[model samples]
Target: MILEPFPPALPYDFVFKLARDSHDLEGYHKLRREIFCEEQHVFETDDRDLFDESAMPIVCKSLIAGMEDTVVGVVRIDERSSGLWYGSRLGVSSGFRRLRHISPGVAVRNLQPCYAALGALGAGLIYKAVSTACALGCHEFLATVQQQNARFFQRLHWQPLENIMLHGLPHVLMRADLNHYAAAKKVA
Candidate 1:
């Protein structure tokens, strides 16, 4: 009997970090517009708002073996008040979705990145945000997620507080359980 060779592994070294320079910042904005405006059709042309002026943006990138770094995902967090934080505008690249049969749970993509690396992209971003919030003395970390993504957050130990409408979309207000994700620990 003939045996098919196992597929070669995809190469990647993923990095999760805060936007440290103009390049990272510009990449983040471009990704947001690409996902939110052009792909999702949630917004007409752009999705920037006053919050972006103060929100801290985080990015997930894939370190290609011999290519430029690709930003595959992004999310923003802001402190609403003392010890209260909010996360929003979670976006993952379409390329990421095409790379792997990722759980509806995680999402992003580009530059021939590994499919496995994209699997944890969303959780990694959230973990970083939670860790940052904790470091900043955040008492509660909250986000309004789309209905389809509510269970994914639940799996990450976030509790759905209520259902609400935002920007004409169905969303659930969720709060991260510090007990479950305390330190922005890396996701395996």
Candidate 2:
């Protein structure tokens, strides 16, 4: 059987920074609407909720020369209580959904192994949010993942604590294994 070759090691520079200004915040929301409301139809019109008021948004932008620093992916995190944090609204722009296919540039050659394994834009965004939670001293990180994507979270070292329903849809309550996500510390 012919084994598939490795993805090309090309330049993949993108800024995975927290939304600090209105522009960043707007971009984050726009990406979320595009993914959830339009693409996934998870929301009727807008996905903004009470959590958005307190959540800290993180965005991934293209770092390629001559290209705008477009928000390619976004995820938000919020502390629900003492030592507990939750990540939500993890989404990537439709056009950039192929983040897994993009290899890192030479500058990121020393990135952690987890980045290599979870190489997609959406995964990277989640890693960033989780890292931020860890840096903020969260004892446990949680998220309600869509049922279909539960296995994807498992691959990223998240354990399903329970199966539940949210907004009339099946979902899984998951917790991140800090050990498997240690790489997030470096970027946090």
Q: Pick the candidate with the highest lDDT.
A: 2
Residue pair clashes in candidate 1: 93-108, 96-108, 96-109
RMSD (Å) of each candidate, 1 decimal: 6.7, 5.6
- Cα deviation at 116, candidate 1, in Å, is 6.4
Clash pairs detected, candidate 2 = none
Best by TM-score: 2
Q: Cα deviation of 87 in candidate 2 (Å)? A: 0.4
Native-referenced Cα lDDT, model 1: 0.75
Residue 10 lDDT (model 1): 40
What's the TM for model 2?
0.83
Candidate 1, residues 1-188, lDDT tens digits: the string is: 99999974443446667887888889999999998889878889999999999898988776665343878889999998999999998887775643443322222322112234434667667777777777778899999999988997887789999999988889999999987555543321
For each candidate, what TM-score against the reference? 0.80, 0.83
